[model samples]
Target: MTAPITQLKTIEQQLLWLSHWMIHHANHVRPKVDDIKVGGHQASSASMVSIMTALYFSALRPEDRVAVKPHASPVFHAIQYLMGNQTRDRLEKFRGLGGAQSYPSRTKDTNDVDFSTGSVGLGVAITSFASLVQDYIAAKPWGETLPKGRMVALVGDAELDEGNVYETLQEGWKNDLRNCWWIIDYNRQSLDGVVREGLFERIEKIFDAFGWDVVRVKHGVLQRAAFAKPGGDKLRNWIDTCPNQQYSALTFMGGAVWRKRLMDDLGDQGDVTALLERHSDSELAALMENLGGNCVETMAEAFASIDHDRPTCFLAYTIKGVVTLTCRQSAKASR
Candidate 1:
C-alpha cells in the first residue's frame, strides 16, 4: 500500500494544479467583457483541499457522501475533472453558459454530486438529514442492501453563524441523528475579517450537548510532534493563544515575520527557543500554519480511526489562503 503521506502529497498537488487551472482558464485564458474577476474562493479551497482529499481518497467508501463548501466548488470540480467525472470543455467554460455551475448541483451539473451546495449552512445541515434518511432506509425491510456509508458535510467555519445550522442541530438531536460528520474548516479568518474569538468554544459545547462527537483538529501531526519537544508546550500554547488577525497578518507577511513574532513572544524559553532556532523563516511559517485540515495524512488517519456511528464534528483548523494566490488578492481588494 502506498504511504498516507505520499497519497496526501499527490492529492494536494492535483488539487492545487486543477483548481488554479480552472480559475486561470476562466479569467485569463477565456475571453471576458466584464473585468469583474470571476471570483473563485481560492483561499477557501486551499483550506479544505487536504480535508477533502483525505475524505474522498482515504476516509470515504463508495457509499459515503459529501457536500463541498461553497467556496470550495472549484476544488470540487477540479477533483471531479481529475476523476474523469468532469470534462475539460466544461472546466474551460467555468461560470459561463452551459459551463460548470457556480456550485455543485445534484440536478443541474453534469458531474456526480451527492448534495447541492451554495446556500452556506443549508449545505452543512443537509448532511444531517441525509444521515437520517440513511437510518430511515436501514430500518426498512428492503434497505438491507443499502450501504452503510456516513453522510458528511464539509463546512466553512463562517457558516456556523447561519441560524439554519443551529436549527439543523436541534432537529438532528431530536431525531437521534447518527453517522453524520460535519468537518468545519475553521480558518478563523472570514470574507470580511477574523471571526469572533471564542466562537468555536460555543460551537463545541453546543455539539457536545447534542451528543455529537467534537474532535478539535487544531494542529497537524507536525505541529503536534513539535509540541512534544522541550519548551514545545510553550510554543504550542502561544499558537493556541495567538489572535486570529495576528495569525493571518503574519501569514500574509510570510516567514520572516513568523520568526520575529515567535521570538518576541516566547524567546529565551528553553526548548521552544531552540525549536524556533532550528527552522528558517519559511520553515517556521509552515510549521506554525500546520493546521489539521491542511494535513491530508492526519485527516485521513482521524477519519479512518472513527469506529462509531455517532454524529461527529471535526473542527479542523486551516489557513484561509495557503495554495491560492487569486483568493487572497480578491479578498484584499474587496476590503
Candidate 2:
C-alpha cells in the first residue's frame, strides 16, 4: 500500500510543477502578439493544490462530484493530466486554441470535469442546489439506479464575498442539505488585500446557524504534534493571535524573517526559544507553513472525519502562491 502522506507530497509536487510549467510555457515559450499576461492564477492554484490532491486522489470516489475554484483551474487540469485523462499537447497550449480553458468547462475541455465553473460563487452555489437536485432525483422511481454522490465545492475565501453563497446556505438549510461539502481555501490573502480578522469565526457561526457542520482545518499534523512539545503551546498561541496580513507578510519574507519575527514576538517564552534554537531556518519555515489546510494529510483526515454524509464545510487555511515564482514576486512587489 502506498503511504498516503508520501503520495500526497508526490501529487503536490507534480501538480505544482506541471501547473506552473504550463503557465510559464504560455507566457514565455509561446510568442506573444499583444503582451497580455497569459495568466494562470498561480497563487490561487498554489493554495488549493494540497486540498485538491487529498480530495481527488484519496477522499473522492468515482461517484463524487466537485466544482473546482475559478482560479485553481491549472491544478485541476494538471491532476487530470496526471490521471491520464488529459494530453500533453493540450497542456502545452493551455489557454490557447483547443487547449485547457482558463477554468474547467465540461463543454470546452475533453477532461471529465463534473461541473463547468468560471465565475466565483456560482460553482459553490450550484453544489448546494445540485445536492437538492440529487435528493429530488433519488426520490423518484426512475432514479433508483442513481447512487448518492457527495457534491463538493473547492472555494476561495474571497468568493464568500458573493451574495449567492449565503443565499444557497439558507436554501440548503431549508431543504435539509446532505451529502455535500464546501471546502474553503482560506489563504487569508485575496486579490484586494488580506482577509479581515476572525473572518472564519463569523463563517463558523453562520454555518452552525444554517445547520452545517463546520470543520476548522487550522494546524496540520506537525503543528498539532508540536502543541504537545515543551514550548509548542506558546508557538501555537502566537500563530493563533497573529494578524492575517502580518502572517502573510512574514511568510512572503521567508524563513530568516520568520525566525526573527518569532524571536521578537515570543522572546524565549517557554520552549519557544529552545525550539527556535533547535531547527534551521528552512525547517522553521516548513514548520510554520504546515497549516492544517496546506497539509494533504490533514485535509485527507478532515475529509475522512465526515462519515455520515451530513452537509459539511471545511475551512481550510492555505498559503497564497507559495511555490510559484511569478505569483510570489508579483504579490511581494505589490507590497
Candidate 3:
C-alpha cells in the first residue's frame, strides 16, 4: 500500500523534473529554426504533477481511463516514458513532427491515451459522456467483458467556465451517470489571469444538483492534520479566505514571505503557534502550499475510498503552473 504511495511521490518528482527539463531542452538545448516560442505550459504542468502522480501510479488500474489535461502534456509524456509506454525518440522530439502531440491524442499519439484532449472544456465534458457510453456498453451483451473502469477527467479550474461543462452536467444527470470522476484543477490561476472567486462553490452545488458527489480536495493530509492543533484553525481560516492572487503571489515570493504572512495572519498563540514556529520559512511555505491536488498520497487515498462509483467531482486545489518552467516564468512576468 505504502509502496505505491512512494512510487506516486517519485512519479510526482520525476514529472516535475522531466516536464521542466523537456521545456528547457527544447528552448536551450535544441537548435531553433523559427522565432516562435516552443511554448510549453510549465506552470500548468507543475500544478498537475501530484494529481497525475496519484492517479497514474497509485489509484489507477489497468482498466481505468484518464483524459490528460491539455497543458500537462509533458507530465503525461514523462509518465508514459517512465512506464516504458512511450519511446525515447518521442521525448527527444516533443512537439515536433513525429513527437507527442501538444496535447495527447488517442488516435495520433503512440501512448495508450484513453481520451484525446486539445480544447479546454470539451475534454472535461467528454469524460462524463464516456462514462455514460461505458454504462451503455455494459448493458449490452457483447461488451460484457469490457473492463469496469472509471472515466476520469483531469480538468483545469478555468475550464469549468466553459458552457459545455454545464451541458455535460445536465447530460450526466439525465443518463444516471456513474463510475466517472471529474478531478478539477482548482488552481485559481488560468492562462490570462486568476480564476473568479467562489467558482468552486457554484461548481459544488451544480455537481450535487446533478447527482454527483462533490469531494473538495482543498487541504492535504499534512495541512488537515495541522488544522486539528490549537492555532491551526486560524491558519486554516486564513488559507481558506486567502484570495487566489495572494496565494500565487506569496508562492512566487518564496518561503520567508510565506512564514511572515502566516504568522501575521494567525499570530503566535499556543500549539498552532508552536507548530508554525517550529518550521523554517521554507518549511512553513511548503506546509502552506500543500494543496490537496498536489499531494499524491492524499489524492490516491481519496481515489481509493470511493466504492459506490457515483459520478464524482473532486474539486482539487492546485497551483497554476506546477509542471513547467516556461509557464511559471510567463505567468510571473505577466503579473
List residue ranges in candidate 2 displaced over 4 A.
1-3, 323-335
User: After superposition, which runs of candidate 3 have C-alpha atoms over 4 Å from their true positions?
Assistant: 1-3, 270-272, 322-335
For candidate 3, lDDT tens digit of each residue in 65-119? 8988998899999999998999878877788778877899987899888888888
Task: Work out the TM-score per prediction.
Answer: 0.93, 0.94, 0.92
Over the stretch 285-325, how does candidate 2's per-residue lDDT look in tens digits?
A: 77778787778778888887788878899999888876322
Model 1 scores a TM of 0.93
lDDT ranking from best candidate downward: 2, 1, 3
> Candidate 1 at residue 122, lDDT?
86
* Cα error, candidate 2, residue 276 (Å): 1.6
Worst 10 residues of 2 by lDDT: 325-334
Best by lDDT: 2
Off by over 4 Å in 1: 1-3, 323-335
lDDT for model 2, on a 0 to 1 scale? 0.84
